[model samples]
Target: MSDDVRNIDDALSRITAYWQPHRLTSINDYDVKVVKIHGEFVWHDHPDTDELFMVLNGELIIQLRDRDVVLGPNDVFVVPRGVEHRPKADEEVHALLFEPKGTVNTGSAGGEMTSPLRELP
Candidate 1:
């Protein structure tokens, strides 16, 4: 995307991979990204930056050690820095994520689920 008007839905439509982040744009050093997620993600936490999740479609459960924060379409949640979170979905979920550039989806717990960042169209 150029330095022009950006529609979140339009950007998300270009993505076909689950658990991978496609960079939508940058706000300072942070990357605005869109991703499709299914099943449960690894439990991890950003040691330096807060992670933002905006549910655009379907539902998401931000499972924490003590509680779960459920989000539906049009809902937003911020997992505070250093707090553990595992994003889970029973079905497909489309979401917009905002976090620092180079932040991995799996945090420090690298595994097969880890994906290299992809540029947005």
Candidate 2:
């Protein structure tokens, strides 16, 4: 494989659109994706794997079944699999997501927010 790689900003620029995630790098069985989020997402749960969300810019609020967690820039949260949750943001937000390869963004609940596995910048 080629050793050359691009930086995060370069990747973000290519994926300026919202909700569409651009695959970055992967470690072992996990893949890293960068996505721009806005508004609210559907409630869902991943029964097979945990998801890591790292805020890169703006802010995000993840609403669980009972409680909610607000994340700002440089903040991070881990959503355990099988727990229903939804993400919301008043303004545009940017974040880095880490999950196992083939892990659907929408998890068990399917909707328009579901994303296909895509290549990174």
Candidate 3:
């Protein structure tokens, strides 16, 4: 993407991998990412930074230690720092994540599913 206005939906459509996030852009200390995912993700938390999940398509359910927050297109939710949370989807869901630049996808729970930081095309 160029150093200009970006359309989130347009950026997401270029992704072909499930659960892999493409960095859309950076805002100060935060990075905006677009990911395509299906099924459940591991429970994790960023101890030092909050994470924002914004659904652009399909449905998503964020499973918190206490309760579940369901989301659909255009919905947004923020997971506070140090809060354990897991995200799941019954079908292919497209979403955008906002968090610090170095925040890992798996947070404290490292595994094979964790992907390296990516760049947007």
lDDT for 60 in candidate 1 is: 97
lDDT of 1 by residue, 9-81 (tens): 8878888878898988888888888899899999898888899999999999999999999999999999999
- How far does residue 88 in candidate 3 sit from its true spot (Å)? 0.3
Better of 2 and 3 by lDDT: 3
Q: For every candidate structure, what is the RMSD over all alpha carbons to the true structure, in angstroms?
A: 1.4, 1.5, 1.4
Clashing pairs in 2: none
Candidate 2 residue 94 Cα shift, in angstroms, is 1.0
Give the lowest summed-lDDT range of ten residues in model 2.
1-10
lDDT (10s digit) by residue, model 2, range 30-113? 888898899999999999888999999998999998999999999999999889999999999889999998898888988888
TM-score computed on alpha carbons, candidate 2: 0.93
Better of 1 and 2 by lDDT: 1
Worst 10 residues of 3 by lDDT: 1-10
Off by over 4 Å in 2: none
lDDT of each: 0.90, 0.87, 0.90
Off by over 4 Å in 1: none
What TM-score, over all chains together, does every model reach?
0.92, 0.93, 0.93
